[model samples]
Target: MTDGEGWFVVNACESRWRDDGTLGSYCTFEGKRRFPHFGININVLGPGEALGMYHRENAQEAFLVLAGECTLIVEGKRRPLATWDFFYCAPGTEHVIVATSEQNAIVLAVGARGRGVGGGVVYRVSKEAARHGASVERETTSSAEAYAEAHADLPRSRWVPYREGWLPSDR
Candidate 1:
């Protein structure tokens, strides 16, 4: 647990969101810093905000709710999630998470990475998600096409105080 050449560290509180400000991520470690093997992001979703278009990917993904609440729409089913809840999606398991709580929700997400992993993400339609205008009607591997009508810039996450003593130790 070090923040050296190979290891990285940053407090979620200090992380800046994308320009859009709908969601924020501690993605520097995995995106710009180029941490390899697997990728990790601390995602913050604002109230009523959808994670993304309803979609499934070739790579396996897991999420841990660190604060607030959300609804997990997976395979057309709605699952409510609260703090400390964990969700895992196998490759091709269509899913999306939408913040339903009044306050913004924080989720720690990790995904497998490597050759032969993450074929791509395909957006799909879901009646449950459609109720919130978060689903797509056609299948498409093009994220650009799926999000063509969306805000051009990616939004950043909002800052919030972490639960006391919940931050992981660097050791």
Candidate 2:
């Protein structure tokens, strides 16, 4: 939906998840068509699911937990996160998010984008991430090399509507 003056608006329910079940699910906003300075996406993770390999990128990235709970593995440290928690990863901060709650978790992610913002990402091995099956055994600058063994298809998954006032339990 256009905002009439270049701004675009879209509900998460309108976007389908990509490559679901293999790890986590994500609905990437059409930033290329609307916003040019940044990228945005909504990530959904089920219990024990990882967001992908532990990696760091040249562009700064941030996340806001919209629902449920998850574990943030960053720089070899583990941080438990719940709904409404926000996380910021400066450029080159190795990290990955894994769902720890019984229910699915949703995260709103944003990242810097523009000229000179290299899209380079390097995968790293982290003991904390290894337990979640997100760690790479070796350092690699190529995503192809980092995920060469992955076989998940890139088809879009069915979209699920978010429930109103859904908050994670205080467990």
Q: Put down candidate 2 lDDT per residue, 1-171, tens digits, no spaces.
A: 332456556765554346455566677655325456787777777888877789998889999999889999998899999999999999989999998999888888898885253367889978888888888778888776676544345443444444332324321
Would you list the C-alpha lDDT of every candidate in the order shown? 0.69, 0.75
What TM value does model 1 have?
0.76
* Residue pairs in collision within model 2: none
Q: Pick the candidate with the highest lDDT.
A: 2
| Count of residue pairs whose backbone atoms collide, per candidate | 9, 0
Tell me how far the alpha carbon of residue 114 in candidate 1 is from the true structure, in angstroms, after superposition.
Answer: 3.5
Relative to the true structure, candidate 2 reaches a TM of: 0.79
Off by over 4 Å in 2: 1-5, 31-34, 115-118, 152-171
What is residue 68's positional error in candidate 2, in angstroms? Answer: 1.0
TM-score of each: 0.76, 0.79
Most TM-score-accurate candidate? 2
Model 1 Cα lDDT, one tens digit per residue, 16-113: 33423443333333323445566777766778877778998878999999888999999999999999999998998999888888777778888877
